[model samples]
Target: MKKQQFVCTSMIPYPSGNLHMGHIRNYTINDVICRKMGIKMFMGWDSFGLPAENFSISKKKTPKLCVKKNIKSMKKQFVDMGYDIVWNKEINTCNRNFYKITQFIFCKLYKCKYIYRGKCISYWDKKDKTTLSKEQIIKGRGWRSGSKVVKRFTKSYFVNLKNSFLKSIIKDIKLSNWPETIKKKQINWIGEEKGYVIKEYHLFFNNIKPFNSLVFSFNNLVLIKKLTKVKKQLNNIISNKNIFYKRNDFIYFVGYKIVYKKKLPVFISDNINFKEFYHPFVLNPFSNIRFKRKMKRKILLNLMFEKGFNTNEIFFKRKTTYKILDWNISRQRYWGTPIPTIVCKNCGVYQERLKNLPVNIKKVKLNNNSDIIKVEKTVINCHKCNCLSYRETDTLDTFFDSSWYFLHYFCKDIRKSKPLDIYIGGEEHSILHLLYSRIIIKILNKIKIVNFKNPFNTLIIQGVILNYSYYYFKNGVKNWIRKINKPKKEIKIYKKLTKMSKSKKNGINPYKYIKRFGVDTLRMYILFIAPINKNFIWNENKIIGCYRFINKVLEFFRNKKNYYYHHHLKYNKFIIKKIEEDINLCYKNFKFNILVSKIMTEFKILKKHNIKNNNVLEKFLNNLYPICPFLVKSINNNFKCQL
Candidate 1:
């Protein structure tokens, strides 16, 4: 008979930096599942994108070097945690094979007419001279360089995902096994607004030659047509920009629909006579804007409800756009994978090919590549096209590296294969990264590059490692603070406002916690103190309680003189029934607290009676092997209880 087969995968983290406690929690839970379930589990690295490149640029190191260092550190941490990871399938997106496939998929999408070129208006860093994604754009003058960013537009490429093909999958896919919060978030990210809003506007055209050059900014920049005949009437009402104006002589009304990214525009009629040119569609609660034209580049993106339109209207009905913004995959940063493209002088256009990608490091000179070309990393125009267009140098979005990493594992063992199994990660990625991964999978599958119909059969999004900052005021000014002085704060104790990260210095390191307290103590304390997803403060005193509990169990085992019938016989069946019920509940909930509680209750009952049945005790110990493996193994090895 064939052995049972099971496939499991962990969402690879970008080697951004050191792994945090939250990351440890994510991997630890997965490791436990893999070990207990007795299945094949795989691990890989998202060793590509911005974090690696950014670190390399900052440290003046190569991205390959940075990733190597980070991977070494992360691997050591995982080993220490006792994770059974299949490291042979480890992947790095920076590799030619990985990105070669990514670019090939891009070509396939392009061939299918799902790819197009357009403009992206945003802050252009004069020093670094690149467009910044929303995350990379700081609230200062410039995120990378100190120079102020200016509003500049660039011609770029985009994948056209606004179709029923992608939309239908989302509508049809059952999220029953997934977390409800994540499902709701993914639904929101898809931005589906059910009913359509319709509006009609009357204006004379320059020559009535059927104007078709109209484009709308879903992020709120509207383009009005410049008509020759209606120029004066339009000029009196509408500015050179898309802003609105009202006149006493004549009245103008505008109408449009707020459509989801994947849906066609129906109609959303909002009649404004003389108000500002801003449409109600632009400002929404979730919407934020960073004006490329602003001098200081304030993150003035938050909606205040007083802007131009009602927050309800904007959020309830989002602007729908069939036109896609260009993929601004260019950056002038010091360190990043060079966009593989060359410009042709005769044709004055750019060309990119997959086979020639991931420029040979040894063949080209880095200094010369940096000095003459202004933009350090770049794509090239096709040498065959003879065009003067420069290559787009911006690297792929770092999120792109992590998005389909789980899929890669399925095919990692094969010479050239596809993804296997499911994606397991924190709840945080559901919005941007996970959504994009779904789109990427669909596009890849549609192109017939991979055989798999769905990227991941199952998705398990774990919760954050619930923790709280421990601080105490000194000098009577409420300023000076220390972590050790405070008591443990449970997630139920205090509501925190910020996420824990290295930059915040908000969490205690597990290494320090373990060194001070035993591993079992820390483990027991963490689970008993709070629910898995909520935050709690780390306190040594609480950990001491766990240590005491373990000591109590050990003492009970060691002190017994005889194991025959010294304890009570009446409650054996009743206690066993209760323990079994708790185990069933634990199987259903997968909750640590409930399992621990049941174990503790059983221990208390066993201790109340003299050491009675060894067989009963052995069964109890085996049941706890999932949570506290080390202690159970230690007891079995030393005592050798006869069942």
Candidate 2:
């Protein structure tokens, strides 16, 4: 038996009709790195999503059919892009076999008491009847359905991320190779905010001792208008920034403390009050008008109680809520994995029997107009009793599918599976996907399902792809162009480099680019144009240089002959060493542009001198094989040389 050398994967693509520039950039980098590692990357699909389901409904096809078609087309494009992908090992989340494993894992976690049914705050789209992530809710509306977002507490399956895993993640995340900004975002999201809530007065304080003035977000306009200012800046503390930024602030009593002593501090507060308290304002004590003195929590509580301020007795309670609360794993859509649980009125909710795993909704019909699943509101009977029960129709969040997909590359048995050598993805996933995966891994380790706490040894975050958007003014109206080239000069045109979007209509159709310039040129030019981890504008003109370089390499291979050589000349070693250095630099800092630029420059020098050394040719071709495999294959076919 032989051990695997390295196991690496890029993020599994969503299998949308055509690959975007961002996909090209990510896959190209992954392909080159895998080639250098002498390992083949596995292509997988994140098949269950809203777009595919919606597309299926619009096309009058089943979701599975639509996904299969998209997957077929995308696989062809992936092969056309020259990626060394393992097609046989491919996994789809919507597949019965794969999601059976997903359901198994869900139940195993439930058995281990890692999952529980809880009420989670979610943004629900009434029209779609689906729960949306925070990002999916744009300006109090659903991004896709254009329905007014209604925030409500929904009963759903959730995992506790704030347990032992919280401490471990914060401690170990520092050792990761993630960017500082990304690390900061993760840390900030998993906030270590500790506070105490005195329900008697609706006051939330950060410190248990309350030595620092506690700032609760007060919404009482009459109270706010009546109070004297603690600081001049405190006058505007009731502004919209408090609501927008989720800032929790304290009240500084001044003008009429005697008149409204009971009503002042006992106002009921909502969830917005539990956030970390900012002590930007001073507190006023009944004894001290200056309000500069500090007192411990016990003293303050006793004084308030004795002074008869609102409450008959002091109620002191410590906070158990965390910033990462109610880690919801449920969605109300048809395209996701059904939550593998059951609810019974007589008995408590429990995992479905292993034999009854993966309550797949593929057979479930969809409403013609609403697009929501049309099925029996009630499902399986309670496993314990023959009592009336219902199956949990809410689907697992797509993140649950992605969090453990990497493990399926080897086998679902985490005890036998090894962590990935490297995993590359975009920075946009730095928050939810990255955090959730790590949390899932930690839970696996905690429950003794897996021996490891982390999923990968190294993680690479890819940058967003950017391009200059061209807009032409037609009859004094700005209209964006969908193609790469500028419009005819008869009309006025403007160009600006920005993020790509369909609404902007500045999207570059990769199929057209590949058809015109060849996929090899597009792959090479993407690597050559800029660093993989930094956003750079797409310049169609810069691709011409890479195109000509590929042509020159092919021409050099065709014009010359291959022969066995005992040793390379001294100058040849220098060029090969420089190539090795650049390759190392690429792996180190993600500077593929520098690597490609260095290779092209050296090849130009070799061409001018008419060098025919096998060492130089082999070195150049081997290095370039990752970036432009089709071009190298053409050369290999002509000369019958082993790359």
Candidate 3:
């Protein structure tokens, strides 16, 4: 009988630098699962991204060189940790052969009418000179450059997401065995708003369009004619009612009036100094705020219709508008998958033929002034018209590189088969990467490229490792201050335990821990810290505890003279049963911490009982192999014991 097929995968990390504690935790969890289940595992680098480009620019080297150096270092680290990954199946998104598949998928999507070009407003960072995704923008600023982001309209390619498609995605999400928190986040990200769009008399105030203008009620017309004098009058009227304080910047109004053959109260309020309103005024009929005496828009529309008013001219039903926008796959940077499209003056825009795929990134020297558009090799002859044309200089977004990587892992020969059985990634990508991957798989399924709709049967979003981040304020600007050993009274240093990241300089390098305590000890320490899904603070003392446990196990196994055979053993039976129960529990709920604790307890019990049965000892070693493979291998090799 054929062995059951099981494939496990994880998010390919960007080769920005060395792996950190978070990377260790994520990969270790998946490695342990795959080993315990006896499944196939594939590992690769998400090597193409802005971080690599920035590093290349800073080092005055090509992105290829930078990526090669970083991947070598990172791969060594993974090997040192004894990850049970199939080295032969490694993939790098930056590789021409691998990206050929990505570009091929892009052409498929284009042919399916899921891809289009349009002018879109994007967050542009002037300092970095690149468009930033919503995820890359932090609190209205660029994440990398810390520059203020401004809106700019640019011609770009987008992946169209229809309302029906979104509903289908959401529907499929409910059927999957994903975390409730992640499901809810995807729902919110694809925000669906339902309401009617009623037309209002614009009154031609401040050049506002009069006909077909959206309004919540007819009373909004009164504010249109405001000469700035009407605002003061409304403010005074509200203040006289003792509803608002005089010192307040503005007062709220609930004025009722008749306009355009309808009598309804139009909710108006001052825009200045009002924390509640995001705009100058809140005018949506479906707004959360409700006036005590105001009638609903639906009721007012019915009354106007009864009065023989032309409903089409005065009001219309609202169309569903989704909050989630189409994905902008265009990026103005090097060190990414080049978009596989060519623009010809005679033939218009045309996707490169599959035979000419990959649109391999040309090797170009790096400089502070490097621009993809200025690169000479970017210009290419059109595949359709055979005329001089330019290749799409902009590279595909990094998210595109990751969106379908799991599927590629299962498609070694591009066969139609089920997707991977398990996927492990960070919760930070719950909305962006996970959602995009699911959508891409569905599209591929519709196009008959794949047999499955979902890529992974199960997804595990690992919790982030966090450390205490220290920073100081300098000249009214917050500066990241590292290496704070002791608090200084005059400096007013601030610190908070947050997610480990390179920008904050709070990430703990896994190499340090690996070198100091050995990979097995570091791995056990991370697994033993807390539950896999919860955040825990980094502590050196706990690492030492793990080191001691490993040494104790080593010492216990080395003394072969102390061993004795116990034929009838009640304690060994109990220990074996307990280990089985812990293994089951770990597989059931991903409670690796609990499993590690139980294993330690079992070791202590074995020592206390002085159990010397070889069969029992081998059973224990097999159970421990997944978590501490290197240590177990060393012990077995030295003692000629089978694990």
Per-model TM-score versus the true fold: 0.68, 0.80, 0.81
* lDDT ranking from best candidate downward: 3, 2, 1
Name model 2 segments beyond 4 Å from true: 1-5, 133-148, 194-204, 207-269, 272-321, 468-498, 501-506, 562-576, 584-589
RMSD of each: 10.9, 7.7, 7.8
Per-residue lDDT for 71-114 in model 1, tens only? 88878877765566777767777676776655555555666766
What does the lDDT come to for candidate 2? Answer: 0.68
For candidate 2, report its TM-score: 0.80
Question: Which candidate model has the greater TM-score, 2 or 3?
Answer: 3
Per-candidate Cα lDDT values, in order, are 0.51, 0.68, 0.71
Tens-place lDDT digits, model 3, residues 1-643: 2334678778888886677888889899988888788765678888887777777777878889889999898888888788877877788988888899889889999988898766645678876678877656776688776667776767778888877888788888889888888888888877765534443421111111222222232222223233122344444554455423333332333344344454533333322122232222123332221121254444544433334334445545444545566777888887789888888789988788888776888877555665332355467767776788998878888888888876666555454567777788888888788888888888888888887788778888788888988877665555665765533557877888888877677888887888789999988888889888888888877799989999999888998644545444456576567677877777667788988887888888778877788887887787788889888988888887776
Top TM-score prediction, candidate number: 3
Which has the better TM-score: candidate 1, or candidate 3? Answer: 3
Q: On lDDT, who's better, 1 or 2?
A: 2
